[model samples]
Structure formats: structure tokens, C-alpha cells
Target: MNKTLVAGALALTLAGCASQQPAPPFTLTLAHINDTHSHFDPSDARLTLDHKAVFTRLGGHPRLLSHVNELRRQAEEAEQPLLFVHGGDAWQGTGYFTLNQGAMNADVLSRMQLDAMALGNHEFDIDNQRLAAFIQGVNFPVLAANLDASHDPDLKGLENLKPYVLYAFDGHEKERVDSVKDAGKRPVVAVMGLVLEDMPDMAAHTGNLRFEREVDSAQRTVRALREQGVKQIVAVTHLGLERDQRLAREVNGIDVIVGGHSHSLLGQFSNLGWADGAPYARQFTNPDGRGITCVVQAGQFAQAMGQVSVTFTPDGRVSRCEGGNTLLSDNVFYRDIRRGEQHRLNEQQTQRLKAEIASQPNIAMVAEDPALRAHIDKQYLPALNRAYGEVIGHLPQALKHVRLPVDGSGSQIAPLVAASQLYWANTPEVLAVTGRRADFALVAAGSVRNSLEPGALKEGHVGLELLPFANPISLVSLTGRQVAGLLLETINASLPADAHTGKFPYAAGLRYTFNETSKGRGYLDRIEFLSQGHWQRIEPDTRYQVVLNSYHASGNDGWSTFFDSQQAFTDRLDLAFTNGKLTAFPVARLSKVNGGGVQVHYINQPLNCQDQAVRCNTDARAFIDYVRERRPMLTALPESGVTLKRL
Candidate 1:
């Protein structure tokens, strides 16, 4: 053979040899779900214009199982190893979960075959013993490197739970290589779980367990796993996304962090940079520096599942990855029978799941308790009768009632109820009015669950009818400016004239108006405070001792302004009522107006219909309009003017 031809043949042979070499890497799929909260049934059903039933379907364990099965099948088809994980908060949100001590949730979770679960605060809502029982019942491990379970009775049993788990997936080629190579050649993946440090206070009732900071616990776990020969590390974090990001940046060795708590919808993995001091942005970095750490979370409820697929090269470094969060609810595989459309789960599978749910007893207890039923009979109804005693007067006709006015503003009902609560509390030197003040009475209209009727007034009715979700009274203090800011935020967030007719409204004794056209966000452009018996301008710098429920005081519903104030005081509202003096008086007559200094009037229009305008000022009119619009949207309105006193 010619020398040139032989040289060309040798080069071709070398090229063929290179083509026969092993493929690049192996891929693994990580599937995760969080905050299922034991919602066995779907959301409520409403009728559409087509007269067809439209259901807001949501979480159910069986449906979740169906989703897992499908995802596993897809992963298998794609030649990826699948690992299922849970980012906790699986217990105590619903009635069934509470009543069963999390048994139902545990059963469902075990059935799903979860590989690991990060401890969530709600897991400790039940006592430690029950939590231990739940842990014993589950087949999978609860991962929490931070939870100190040594001393507490409730958490002592958890000492057996592993802080981390390592998984090995061997594909055909890897298996062949393993058989030919040394025994230590198999590839392994490690997962670590870390609970949030705030779990101790949040889940205080669960037991006397202590939790270290998430970042510290995660760092220790990563070090330990690395020592144990873990090639790839994933941290299952139950901390909120903010803390999760902090963990990803602070902890160096983790390859991926599956996080929960804040219910973030992370569609795909993203880079989280270190704190301002770190040298570089925190990215996924494997042992060999071939890949970056990926972090992901699926939103609350079982509405969606998160998938992270990572491919590892022969050297144990992640080479390539591709995955996205998927919404099982939108899939065509499960049919939404209520929608009259064939969608996801086949009819047989759907029925079986439904049967499984139906077989479970006491699930309805998740929403309402039998104790509430008893209270309605023995305590609530009688209290209503006594409070509304001696029919003072009667409505001329059956007038339409609204919880709040249609306009985007505050409702009168909330302040009225707050005043009633204060009256019941009978605090010494307490200022009683429907208005805003630092260390003064403030209540949200959304907290008012019932309304009064248009019939003859009777005793006990006010106690029974007005607010059904009678929360324990909580008190908090704030400055006048802080109070004002809270009120403004509530109104601005609720009523933007450009939005819908009915939105959340603010109810206060202080008079306030906004120029919907001029003021950005339409906050309190016009403000008045009730003083002695007249409306007066409120000074921004003034400080006042305010009494409000913990709900509003804690800045729920955009009331963060309260938190920005000076020194604040707090106590339960129910305790305030029970401990303070109480008095009962006869209802001589119903007055159109109570003690007031600030009067509210609509800027351009009547608050309500002429016939319904008897006591309708601007505040009342705006509230009526707001309520009228939202009536169709709510399940039920607060029983009008009814109050419940806890003794």
C-alpha cells in the first residue's frame, strides 16, 4: 500500500475509535411540591354565562399522585432518574388534617413515595407527640439539619430521621462501566434538608424543639455530605424564598436548592448572588467547577409541580440541564368533569380518586367545626336575641343590604363593629368612635363577616348577627402618622377608581376623601379627625395610643404603616372584653348618627339609592356601593349588626 493511503486509513481508524467512545453524561430529575395543606376537595363551583358549571379545581392528593405518575413516566422516557421531594408545611391548615393529627396527609404523602420532606412550621401545630406519631407513620424521612430533636418529647422521636439522603442512579452504560470498574465507581447524588430558623417561634406549640439558622445548618450538612462522598448535593429548604436565596448564596457546596414557604412560582432555575461582600455571583458550581447551583420552588397548594433535571458528566460534574415547572391543572390528561370537558385524568381514574376522597370521614370538618354548630344553637343565637331585645323599630320595606359600598372605599360596618367590641371591652377612658387613631380603634371591613337584617330590632341580635369570625381582640399601638399611612395604604390598595366597582374599603370614624383624578394612588387627599364633637385636621407628627386587632396591627391586608410607628402595645381583643368592665342598656331608639366629629360625603355622586339614603352620608353611601358590587362574589355576608361576646 502507498504510504499516503496508509496514513489516511490510520487517521480514519482513529476518528472511528473516537466516535465509539461513551456518551457525555447521565441526567436526573428532581420533582418537588409544597404546602399541599390537605385540601382534599377542589375549589368552589360557579355557573358561567353558558349555564355550564365552572369549578376552580385545586389540590387533592390523588390528583397530585396522578401528576407524579405522569412526570415519572416522562422522566423515564427521557432517560432521566427521578427523585420526588416535598418542601413541607403539609399539616394543620385544614380541619381534616387538624382532626386527624396529620394522619391523612401522612398516608397520602407516603403513597406519593416522597424521597424526603423539609420540616415546615405547621408540622408542629399539633403537639410534639402527634408530630412524632406522624413521623413514625410516614415511610420517608423528614429532613431538617437544623432541628434539635434531642430533648423535647414531641420531637425526640425525630432523632431517628436522617438529616440527608444520597441517591444513586445507574443507567445501562454506567452499569456496564460499574461492572467492569472498581466497586467504588458508582455515581451518587446527595440531598440535604434544612428547616427555617423561625420555625421555633412559629411552630412553638408543636414542642420545645430548637432550630438553628438555615444557612448555618445547610453549611454543616453540605460539609458532612461531602465527607461522606456525596458527588452532587441538593438542599430541600422549608424557609421562605428570601431566606432560600440567602442559603444558596451563603452555602458553597450545594448544587441545587429545592425551596418552599413563601410559595414562589419559579418556572426555571435561576442564579442567586451572594451578599454584597461575596467575591462573585452565586451560581451552580459542582465539585469540579463544571456547573452552577440551581434553586427552584413551586407555588403553594398542589396547583403546580417543580422539576429540575440535571445531567452529570463522567467526572461527576453537572454538564447540561433542562426543566421547567409544570401545572398539572392545565394538562389535558385529567378531565374536569364539572367543566363538561374531557381534560386530564380519565373518567375511571377521576372517579376512583373521588371515591377515595368520599371514603374519608370528617373531611367537611376542615372548613367548619361541630363546635361552631353547637355555639350557633346554644350561645350565638341566644346572644343575638338578647342584644337586639325589645323591637325598637321596623324597616318600612325589605331594603337591599350590602356589606360594603360599591365604590372603592372603607365601609362603616367595620368601624361600627369595632366600636361595639370596644363597648363590650369597656376599657377605662377609652375613646369610642368609628375612625383612625394611633393606639385607637381600627378594624378592616373584610374582617366583618355578617350583617344585620331590615326587620324589627330585637335583643341579642347585635351579638349574634354582626361579625361571625369574632376573633380574639388584639391591641397594638402606633403613631398618628403611622395610623394614617395604614389607612391610606388600605384604601389605595383596595379602591383605585380605574379598577372594578367593588373592591376592599376602609371604615373609619375619621373623615377622609381622595381626589381620584389627581392624587397618585388616590390616598387620603382630604383628611379630618374627630375631636370632642367636630371634624379637625390631623397633625402628621401627633402620637396616640391605638387599640386594634392583631390582624390589622400586624399589618395584614396592606396595613404595614402600623409597623412603621413608634412604641406599640398589643393584647387579645377577647381578653380585653372579658377582663374589662361590661354594661347592658336598653335600646330606646335607633339613631341615624352616633357620636361623631368627622362626616364623609361622596365627591360627585349620591352614596346610595334615594330610598336607601335615609342615613346615607358619603362614607355610608360609598360603603353601600362597595358591598352591593361584592355581594355576588362572596359566599355569604356578615349577619347584619350581630355581635358575639366571648366570656
Candidate 2:
């Protein structure tokens, strides 16, 4: 009621309003890596040492740790909010993973102090049980937004796996009186995980853990986070570059994406006329058009690290991004020396850059962290030495990949795989069931990761080459129509994959005349199957027993044709080949070997898929067994004894 008091109160209110300000811009440095793939040891990098280019391996857990530690220190000095994250596939690909079954990588990654990681398909290579154990071992959050693991007793309640986490780094939230919409305190970051939708096709047994569509899961998650008043959102994904780009375009709330799984070297890849791409990070307009989204990925094998520097407005929109792939590659620097780029091994420009390398600075290659190296050498190498290096056999000649393994040509490994599968199909037990020998075996090129090198091939070498996916061997019955369809799909998968994709199917006891001209899954000109001792043109209605890896038998890699017409999207199938007749042994019934000692196994049994559990997984075991018993040494290709001709 007093005029003086009212004036005083008004003045105080005005003063408080004048002092309040809008929230200042926040900057964050997001460091990302993907697809380390059990490459515990450093890679052989090409570098310049002693004034000349030399081949040296770089990148191993030791250097990876060292490289990241140095970067963190640099980031701390710059006073930037830094977050270290992995995109996924930390398991499988090397002897280190094969021996420890990912436990070793888990401990090593934990030491790296990751803020978070997405679940890669390889994480499920073993089974849900092992995946649960791996999740338990790591200290960081393991995320998969679409995961539903409630049904399995081991993964119930889903406490161990989180879809999205309201994660915070070393940063602070503040009050912003200047803007009513921006006035609040929240954590520094919110990272959501989205894995590949193709996990069912990749893993033989995922145990009841189901994956929802990434976009659907992401939409729901973003809404939930936004409702909770969190602004900054990052999607750490294993969906690779193409899908991640699509995600950036489609998803509303995601600000940045750190991705993996295609092993794509986004920005750092040499444009060798292969797949060309933009530099490490690219910006896309959001689907809602409210903001811009940045996408980034580090190349596979821990050989490089992606650093994304982002500035965000108070409302969580990205202002700008400065990000690129840092080649921590200890391999030499020649990859950067574009062939005609003013400098070559014989060029004068080398005098300047080469001198820099020859001088005291000595072109810095990420030195292996002594502590991490010691851990790997002392604790890890023993198993690797015992399991991987022990000589399984000696090779007389190098088994070079002559052709792309896809389309059933290019690599000796393809034909060799067919021969190996055929041997197993013809084994006494399998022969007794179908009352006939298997017509042919189906093998997809992607299944083999590496080639058999010449010299004393070690058991660990085989494990690394084949990769340890415990996928079982399966026998299925298919009519000639289905088999022919499969062959066509295999051819269509061959070309673009001559060096990239690996869905091509190779066969033994089967030969096909392919007409590349007809195009689009109908490329097959003719297909033949081996009969009692001769090759016969396959009949469309005739049923033949086929031996293939369990992954394919279960209808993956474009082979959905394997299942009967009635079944689609079916899970946990124990499929048995029942109806139809084989031309070779049409008269013979189940469990009876007709003539020629070729009895086959028929299915009265449900197709319960089980782990082969050999010392080594993949066909590497069969390759080893075939080598020891049959050729003891490979002088040339087609060691499986089934060479082919195209008519």
C-alpha cells in the first residue's frame, strides 16, 4: 500500500530480470570407433622411417589406447567436453576373440573407459547367453533400442541392456532466463542405441532377444527423451553408413550418429575407383527440418578414430560440426600420397614432406602404449600362440583369391568350400537317411573372411580366416525350382561383391551355365547336379537333398527360398526335407542306401539346430580335416576333387 515500497519492489524485480541471460553455447568433442573385430594386435601400417617409405604394422589395443589417451589429454587441454564411444562389433574376427570368446576385448574396452557402445550383430555370434555375459563384463552401457529380451530366463527384465541412456559427460547444465523454452538443467548428453535389423540373419541363435525396427524404436525413444526435457541426443548405431544416412534423414530428435557394421572407411578410404565417399562426417537436413544432423563412422579394425566436434544451441539444435577420420594407421603414409598428387616416390615434393619425416619430429606414428602392450603380450598372446599359431599343415603354394568369391567364381576358396560341404553330405550317417547322396552343397562367399596363405598354416590362422561363428551344418530338401532359384540369387550377388559383398553361393556336385545377360535373378542359363557317377540336367519338380550351413538352411542371405512355400518369418525352425523324389534314387525309401553305397538321411526328425562346438567354427574345421585326410598339402585349387565346366 506504500508508494515507496512498491517502487523499491519494482526496481528489485527489474534488476533481477536485467541480470538473467540466455544459456551460452556448449561445445562437445565426440570420439567414435567401430568394428574393432578382435584385432588385438596392431596392424602392419605403411609409414616413412629412415627417409624412405617402409611397411610397418600399426594399430593394436596398445596403440589404440595410446592414441585415444593422447587425444583425451589434448581435449582436456582444449577444455572441450569429450566423450569416447564405440559403435559396435567389438567381438569376433581374430584369434584373440576366438580364444576368449570376447571376454578379452570386454576387459580391454572397459579399460578404454567407453561412455557407451551399440550392440553389433557379431556380439550375438555365440548366443544370447554369451552376449549377456559380455554385457555383464563391460562397465559401459550396452545399448539396443529395439531389443526385447523378456522371454528368455537369462535376459529377463532387461536390466543389463538399455535402449536409451540419459548419459552425461564432464559438462554442466544451467539456467537461461533469456529464453523461456531453454530454462532448465539437464545432463550433458543422451545417447540412444540402434542395431542392425538383420541380426536374425546373422546369428544362428539369438535366444528370444528380438529386435524391433530401428526407425520405429528410435521414434519412440526420441519422443520419450524429448518429453523428459533432454535436448542433446546422439544415436550410436551399428547400422553402417548408408542406413545411418537414411536414419539421419528420417529420425527427428537425433543430432549426431556414430555408426559401424559395414566396415566402411567413410572419409579416409583411398578412391581406388572402388566406392567413393565424402570425408569422415557429413551433414543432413533433419526430416522435421528443425535442425541438421551429423553422421560419422571410424573405419574398421581400430585402425582409425573419428573425432566429431559439435556445438549445440540451448534448445539442442546442432549449430555446426567439425569432424573427420584421423588415420592412426601405423601403416605407412603412402595411402595419403595420392598417386599423381605433386609427389610420388620419385617426385621432388617428397623432398619437403620426406624431410619432415626424416627429421627430429619423425612423422609421428601412434606408439604402442607400453602398459596395454604388456597386458596383451603377457596375458593375451599365450592363448593366441597355443591356439592360432600351432601348425595345422604346410602349404606348398599360396591360395590367392583368384576371383571374387561371390557368383561362385574368382577364389579357389569358393570351389574348395563346395568340395568340403559335399564331403560331409556324403558321410555315412547323412547318406543313410535320404536313401541317396546329397546332390550338392551350398556355400555363401561371405562366410569365409580370409584366404589360406601358403606355408605352415596354423590352427589360429584358420580360426581367424574362417571366423568362429559356431553355425552348424544343416541338410535340407528342396525341389529343383527352389534349388535353381537359389543358384540365380547366388549369381546376382556375385559382381558388386567381387571385392565388397559376399552373398555368392558356391557349389560342389553342381555346375551351372549362367546367362549374365538375362539379368535380375534369372541369370542362370542351365544347372546340373551330379547323379550316381554322372552329371544330369536338374529337373524342376525333382526333389534333392542339399547340404549347406545352418545359417543358409534357416533362410538367410537371400536364400529364403530354402523354406517351404508356406513358411515366412518363422523362427526357431527345425526344418526337415520330406516330400519329392530324387532322380538318382527315386525308388529307395527313407533310411535305405540303394546302390553305389550312397545312403541318405531322411527327416522324420524335427530340425533342432545345435552347435557343432568343434575346436574351430566355420568351415575351417572341415577345410583342415579335408586337408589332413585328403591332400595333406594343397598343390593347387579344387583339392576337394570336384572341378567344374560351363557348357
Candidate 3:
């Protein structure tokens, strides 16, 4: 053979081998928000600055959309693949959801151009039929691989509700690169949604849909995607941060997890008096021990946006992950002073704080998107304005709401809320119906969505924003033992301190001590009852008249003890705003136990509005009336209501 011919053949062989080599690592960017909970307007957020509390506003859909759109523009200019998603809980946080239901959510969210969304547990806050309607109304597909909606007539075979959504990025035109077939031989990215397997416990109206375990569902989905030649996998999950980490560790082939449900602020913010959760985009070692999965979650209530840029190798392992949660806020800042007046921050101080915020990776001062803001103003702000205008009371001091009690102190406002319920129960009309005044009232920590800042308290703050759920006040009788057991069951359900913290209990007219080392009685060491202005040990055999929100009264949110004890009792009564009057009636009962032992019930009984009786309202109404009439200043309790002891 000629020498030149042999050399040319060798060069061609080397060129063919190079073509077969795996592709270089590619970059993809994601802009995400979770647990937005219908915050279409800026919300009050407090941060410590210069040893003083600075009141400012954070997020809202408009601001969040601005941040996301800018990021998308930047990514498009850079010719990088990008996606925007919502982790979950897009409904039921503010007055908008209270008034407009899912219509407003679908309309506003559809405008944001989301690639996909996780079917958050709150989406089931209504029912399967309503959820199906919302899904149909939204432009983006709602993904939920673990959900088997076959039993639900409305959800089964729903066109927009999918197990997974696929995307493929070509060299340019990021917006047009959704189909895998369009990009021949290019890597496809699969995004799947995973909700809580025990979703019915958190959301009562999930209907007949069944939730499979998160880990098993994720693994199965990833395996299927891998077999189909999809390399990059993202799980947009409603599982809290802890569960996301667990899924990352237990499962294989997951590249990233965009998580919600815990409302975790997954970045450094402790210096501002905020919880510095685990760093955003932190990689967890996969089950294979070599592959890496990055997890990211923005804080709740439309307060933050999570922007993550990931570098993925050919085999779908996360090579490098960056980005953190950015808290979008307005330029305004204030401090409370004498006579409950808000002192606006000076220009110099505002500039200094803004400079500091700019230096931080997790906070951004962004202006609201004008078009979205205008749309909200035209379509939604009228009802919210009316709701916010009604001043219910005033708070002289700020009260923080921490779900898990720390240093033997629980939520300041939760106790106040419970006291309000107790006040309603003791009202003459309510007492007459119950045949006696109530002993105490208990409310879940989750029921109180926000802390009470020192300011003019509005009716919307309680009814539309804080306790926005339509839960009524219900009265029940329980022995001291059952009361103790109820507390234990709820506290244990919120255990591990990282997940399900919402179920932690807070009370008024009662107090308890928790011992960490004591396994006996599920860490509840002591129980006390307030009697004649003195604390006394509760008598286990004594039947006490207790007032609780209807949600807990029905055993939702892991309050199984409430359901177990009350399910068989015919004495349960719910206080409702019937015909504009507060009236008591028999608690609604389900025909039978459903999946997860949840006894679904509804207030379907017909009532005569013509009957002569004093009308009253429940839930937020009770709290509003209590604040306006009983304690406008909202002072702390006489003594700490909780004590914690460690081994």
C-alpha cells in the first residue's frame, strides 16, 4: 500500500472515534417559585437591620414575574436552555383565592409562560372537579407522576394533567424547543411532578385520587425516562425540602429537584433574622453514591424566586449546580415607633440597606412587572382593596409565628388566635347552644399563616391572608387524657423538626411541657389547665369543653386523634355564619372512612334563615370580633404556654 493512502485512512479512523465520544457538558437554567399561595400583591416582610426591625414588602406575582422574565431574556441572549416552573401550592394563601377561587390563578399564571407546574396539594383544596377545571383553564401542563387519578372521574385521563413533560433544546430559539423529536439525536430532559403520598392528610378535598410513595414513584419514572434515552431529569415536587433530600438520596438518575410544601428559604438569610435553610442547589449524593442531585426551593407566599443553573454530563449526572433564592422586595422601608406609628426609613438608611441587599446573593430589589400589575389592578384589586380597608384591630407589639416551638416558647399569635376562639365559644349565644362555656381553645400553628406585625390589623389580614381557609369554629367535649393524646398525636405528626411542622399545636387556656428524651406518652411530659386564673394539673378523667377549628375537629392535617375520638360522637357542633348569623349545628359526618382513614365531610344540611336567633360568624370573624372588642393591643400571654426539656 502507498504510505499516503495508509496515513489518510488512519486519520479518518481517528475522526470517526472522536464523533462517537460522549457530548460535552451542557448548561440549563431554571427559574422557579414554590408555595406562592396566590400572593398577587406585595406582602409585608420583616428583616433586622442595624439591630432594628425594618418592615418592607417582598415578592408578589408581579415582582416574581419581572425577575423571571429578566432571567429568561438573559438566558435567551446567551443562547442557553431555560425553563420556568412552579413547585406547588399556587392557591389559597390570600384574598384573591378566597374570592375568585382558581380562575384568577389560571388567568394570571398562564400569562407567566410557565413550562410546567407540580400539582400541589392545595390544588386539591376544593375537589377533583374544580381541580380539573383549573387544570383545563391553565395553559401549562400540570405534572404528577405519583398520582393515580383513575378513581376520580374528573381527574382521570385529564388532557392537561400529565405524569411527565419532556423538553429538548436546540442550538437557538429556546422557546420553540419543547419537543424531543424536533431535536434529532439530542438529549431530552424529563420533568416529573411528585406530591405527598399522604396528601389527603394535608389536603382534605383530594377526592378519590391515590398518591403513590414519592421515592418509589420517582425511581420508577426516572427508570422509564432513562430507558427512553432521556438523560436529564428534574422532579418538580410538592414534597418539603426534607423529603426532597430523602428522594435525592434514595433515588437514582434524578438530576435536580425543585421543591415546595415546606416553604423553605433555601439559602443564607440568618443575618437578616430569617431562617438560613440548607443552601439552595445543594447536591445530595444519589443512591449510586457517585451521581449527584441538586435540590432547590424558594420560600413561601410568593416571597422568593429560585434561579438555578445546572451543568449536566452526558449520563445525566449533575456536574455543577449554582444559584440561590432571591427575595424580591420594594424600596420602601419602615420602623415602628411611639403610638404605633410607622417611621419611614431615611433616604440614606434606605440606600445603605439597598446596597447591602444588593451585595447579598439571596435578596434582590425588583420593580413589579407593569402589565401584570395593571391586570391585577383591573381584575382583582377591587375586592382585595375592600377587604384590606376594613380595620379590625391594632397590634401594639410584633408577634412571630414559629411552627416548632423553640426555647420553651411557641407562636405568640397562635395563642391569641386560640384565645379568640375561646372568646367566641364563651359568647352568650354560643354558650346557650353548647349548654356550657368552653374550657379552652386550640388552633394549629399552620392555621396562622403569618406573624402579627405592629400595625393596624385589617379584617383581610385574618380572613383573607392569614387563616384564609373556610374552616369554621367547632365545639367538642374531650376528657383530659384525650386532650393530651390529641396534642401528642399532632406534635408527633410534625416531628423530625424539619417536615410537617405545620401540624404542631398551639393552645390557649392550657399549657404543656415537652421532653425530648421521654418516649412515653409521645414526649408530652406534663399538661396543665387554667382554672380561676391559676395553673393546675389537668384531671385526666374530667370532661372539658373544648373549642377547635373545624379542620382539626375533622382530623385533617394528621390530627387523627381528633377524628378518632369525635368520629363516633354525635355531640360535635360547628359554629358557622349561617344567614349572616353565627349559629351552631351538628358536625357533618362522612358516610364511611376513605383512603388514609380520612372521614370526608361537608356542611350540606339546609337551614331556616327565618328562625329568630342572634347571628354570628366563625373562624376569621371570631378572631376579628375578639380583637376589636377584647384585646386591641394584642399583648403576650400572662405566662409562657410551652416548656421544652431535653435529655
Candidate 4:
């Protein structure tokens, strides 16, 4: 061979080797929001890293759009594929959604250009017709693999609701193959979605729909996507964090799981192998073993946006993943107040957007009437007073002021309502009663919405606070054993001793002692049921007709033990009571007696008002006098007459 030929061939061989090398990994960015629930603005307050609190000034739709646009700009500059997704519960929180059947919020969501969203429980609040109408207006796909809309005539039109979608970047294959063993270009990217299995029951009011098994639906969807020649897969799920993790571990072939529902803030990669005793064994190799599925979710209410970037190898395995939740309203992101005109410019820009939207006819409907709306100042006090008047015999003190933290028992008005219902049901028709049956109730400290001021209590305010959610009463038949099991579960679910020292159940016709340090859930040592003005032991084998809010009857508060017992004769408790007939119930007077006067014999702890911030420290007679003077109009009741009639 000649020297020239040899040199040329050698150069060609080296060029071929370089071309066969793997292509550089590309990054795909996913932005997500969940449980927005019509909160177009930031929460009650925005917190800083230094723990300094600042009231939010900019959180309306316009500001959010600006922020989203900015993030898209930055993502585009980075040459990353960006996909915007929502985790569900987009409608039915405030007047913006409820009053208009989610019309305004749907318009806003459409304008925002959501790429995909999962089905949330609240989406069904308005029924199937309204849900379908809302979905029809949205440009993006509403993904729910488990929901069977075939049976529902209203939702049958939502044929566009798919389990998954595939987005492919053309010409990516040639580059990837040239860089890796001289193969062809990379395949298309696919994103799948799954809704929670319990969505049907949870969202029963929204529509007449049903959800299938989540794991089965996910498996089927992943298989179909793989069959369609789409290798890169992303699962946007509304099954919550724990269930999402479970889905990731059980369902194979899924590359990532974008989670929602539980509202977890997950940006960094967390190993799901620990779930269900699975080991963190990498299933595929991409030069770097980044694992099979990457899961991420943003917290509820658009408080933060999640950014997840994943790199896929030519062979379709994830090489790397990185992301974080960006604080939309931080000092760094905003113009400093000290900047004066600059800050004012941002404010002006925000105001202009708000004005543009505010000018719309729908904005007038969004404005809530404080008079009718349930707020601490307007509704809770009156309801509390009515319940107290019906249950309590007399005011203990001359002033009869029920101080906040009423008895230093860590009980609240809701629990008191539960207790009152229990006490009311303690007749011959109701053999035995357990659960939240007390005139003086205590809910989880987290449940109390607000505190009352030192003044006369009114029926209106009490009604507002007690019945804020408009949940009706329910009655359930349970054996004595089942009742005892439920009490144990309630104690087990309460806060730990070291976490919050003072905790007590709201008492109606009963009082009990609980030892927080006890193990195995049997924390209640002695339960005393009041009979003929005396405390007595409750028999364990007798049947009882217990009355409670529908929320509790269904075992929402870790009272699953009650339902697990398979008791019979479950009925709506609301059917047993009449509205307005119990109007003169004095909550303040009841609080004054239950607040501190008599130490119920069961628990050694003395009843004293500890937390002044929440207790009702107002003169009962004076508050009633004040109510008479002000005479706020009563809310119009439904056609149901005022009488305690059983359903």
C-alpha cells in the first residue's frame, strides 16, 4: 500500500470511532401544581427563610401568569423540554368555583395552558353535568385511567380523557444513535396519568362515576404505551404520595411518577425501593444507574411550582434526574420595597392584570357576602350558643364568661357538638352511646378555625362555626365492642404526649380518662356515662345508636375500627334533629360551667382555662343582650321543619 492511502484510511477509522460514541444526555423538565382548589392567590401569609412573616400582596391570577411565563422563559433558554401538569382538585373551594360551577376557574386554567391534570375528589362537587361542562372548556386532557365514565350519560362526552399522552422530539434518534454504537435515533417521550382509586366514593357528590383499581389501571396503561413504540414514560398521578410510591414500586415500565393528592413537596430523588420491602436494585443501565421511576409533586394551592429534569439515554433508561420547588413569592424573586419606583412598577403591573380580570362580569359573582358566608366573626359563635343552651342546664358564674381554652382540656366546640349529639341520643330508643357525645366537645387542636371574643354569644355565629362545611348529621348502629374499639382508635390517632401535653375529649353526657403514654391503642382507663345526673360505667356488649356528623360516621378520623365491625342500621343523623327549634341554646353559659367549675370525677386533672387565645371569656347574659340589640338576620333554613324527627 502507498503511504498516502494508509494515512487516509487511518484518519477515516478514527472519525468513525468518534461518531459511534454516545450522545450527550438531554434534560426533560416537568412543572406541576396540585390541589389549587381555586386559591388564585398566596395563602393567609407568606413565610421567609428567616421566619419573618409578610402578608402576601401579589397572588392573583395575573401575577401567577407572569411568574409562570418567567419560568417558561428560563426553561426554554436552558434547551429543556418543559411540560406543565396539575394534580387535581382544581375546582370547588371558594365562590370562584362553587357559585359558578367552576366556570371562571376553568377559564383561568384554560388560559394557563395546563398540559394535563388528574381527577381530584373536589372536582365532583357539582355533579357529572357540571364536571363535564367544566372539562369541555379546558383545552388540556383530564387524565384518569381508573374512572369508568361509560356508565354515566353526563360524562360520556368526555371521550378525550385518556390515560396517557406521548410527546416526541423529532431528529433526536439520529443524534443519539450516532453517539451510541451507530444505532438509529431515540424514540418518542410518553406521559401517563392515573387518578386515585377511592375517587368515586370521595367525589361521590361531583358525579355518578366510579374508579377502578389504581395498580391494575396503571399496569394496563403502561403496557399499552410500551406497545405503541413509546419508550420514555411519565405517570402523572393523583393517588397521593404514599400511594404514588406504592404505584411506582408495583407497576413496572413507568419511567417517572408525577404525584399529587397528598400535597407532598418532592423535588429531590427519593428511593421507592424501601416501600414494601423492595430493594433499591437498578433495573436498567445508562452508564449511570438512575433507577426505574422518578416521583415528584408540588404542595397544594399553587404555593410552589415543581421542576423535575430527567435525562434519557439512547436505550431509553434514565441517566440523571434533578429538580426543586421554586418559591414564587420570595424576596429574591420580587423587587425590594426599598427600591421604591421599581417595586411600584411591579405592583402596577400586577394591578393592571387584576383590573383586567376584575372587569369581567364573573368577578362580581366571585365577591363573597360576609353576612351570609361562614367566618369566625359571623357564624361560629351563634351555633355554639344554641348547642350550649340545648345541652347545659344553667350558667355557673354570675358573669358566666366562658374563657378561651374553656377548661384547659384542649377540647374545642366541634367535639362539644359531638358530645351534645351523643348526650341527646341517650334515651331508651338509644341503648348506649359512645363517640363524640358531649355538650362540651373538643376537636383536634388543628380543627378549631378561630377563637371567640369576650362578649355575649349569638346563635348565628355559633351556627356558622359549627356547620361551616354544611355537613349533615348521621346515625350509625354499633355494638358495644365496636364502640370501644373506635374510642381506642381515636386515642391512638391523637397527638403524642410530648408533642402537646394537655389533651381531653369534648364531654356531653360522658367523661373519660385517657393516658397518652399507653401503648397498643387501649388508652382509655375509665369511661363514665352520665345517667340521672350521675356518672356510671358503660356496658361493653350493648348496642348503641350514636349520632355524629357524616364525616365521622364514615370513619374519617381514624375510626376505621367502627366500620370494620360491620354493624347494621346506619342512618343519616340530620334526620333526627330540627333546625332553628334549638335557637335559644346558650353556648356561653354551657362553656362557663363545663369550662372550669366541676372537675368531672374520671380525670384527676382540674378544669381550668389555660389558653386565653381560644377560650370564650364573655358574659353569657351580656352577649345575649348584645345579640338582642344587634339582631343579625337569621340565615334562611331549608323547607325542612324545626323538629327532632328520626329518619
Q: Per model, how many backbone clashes are there?
A: 74, 28, 4, 54
Q: Which stretches of candidate 4 lie over 4 Å from their true place?
A: 1-19, 46-63, 170-187, 206-208, 266-290, 330-469, 475-479, 487-538, 542-545, 551-572, 576-647
| lDDT, candidate 4, 1-647, per-residue tens | 99999999999999999999987665677777777767654343222211222223324344455556666778666655677888887764433442345776677777777778887766875567778887887888888877777767788757557666656553321121211122234446666678766553344253445677998888888777667566677878877666776676777777777777665554321221111211111133212234477777766565566677788876566777666654344222123323234433355544543454344321111222233223322423343334443221221211111111222323333343444344344422322322323222223222222233323334433433323333433445566566556666655443322111111124344456654454323356676555667766767886655555443444433445434443332332222112312111111111101111111111222222232322211112212332343322221112111111111
lDDT of each: 0.51, 0.65, 0.81, 0.49
| After superposition, candidate 1 runs with Cα above 4 Å error | 1-24, 44-56, 75-79, 157-160, 171-185, 204-207, 268-291, 330-471, 476-647
Model 2 alpha-carbon drift over 4 Å, by segment: 1-24, 44-54, 169-187, 271-279, 331-364, 395-412, 423-435, 452-454, 464-467, 488-502, 509-538, 565-618, 629-647
Instruction: Give the winner by TM-score.
Output: 3
433 Cα displacement, candidate 3 (Å): 1.6
Root-mean-square deviation of candidate 4: 15.1
Provide C-alpha RMSD values for all models, in order: 15.7, 9.0, 3.6, 15.1
* lDDT measured at residue 104 in model 4 versus the true structure, 0 to 100: 66
lDDT value, residue 147 of candidate 4: 71
Best by lDDT: 3
- Candidate 3, lDDT over the whole model: 0.81
Candidate 2, residue 508: how far the Cα is off, in Å: 4.0
Against the true structure, candidate 1 reaches a TM-score of 0.55
For residues 53-114, could you state the per-residue lDDT of candidate 3 as single tens digits? Answer: 88888999999889988998898788788889999899888789978888999999999999
- Please give, for residues 562-617, the per-residue lDDT of candidate 1 as tens digits: 43342232221212221232111111111111211111122233222123312211
TM-score-sorted candidate list, best first: 3, 2, 4, 1
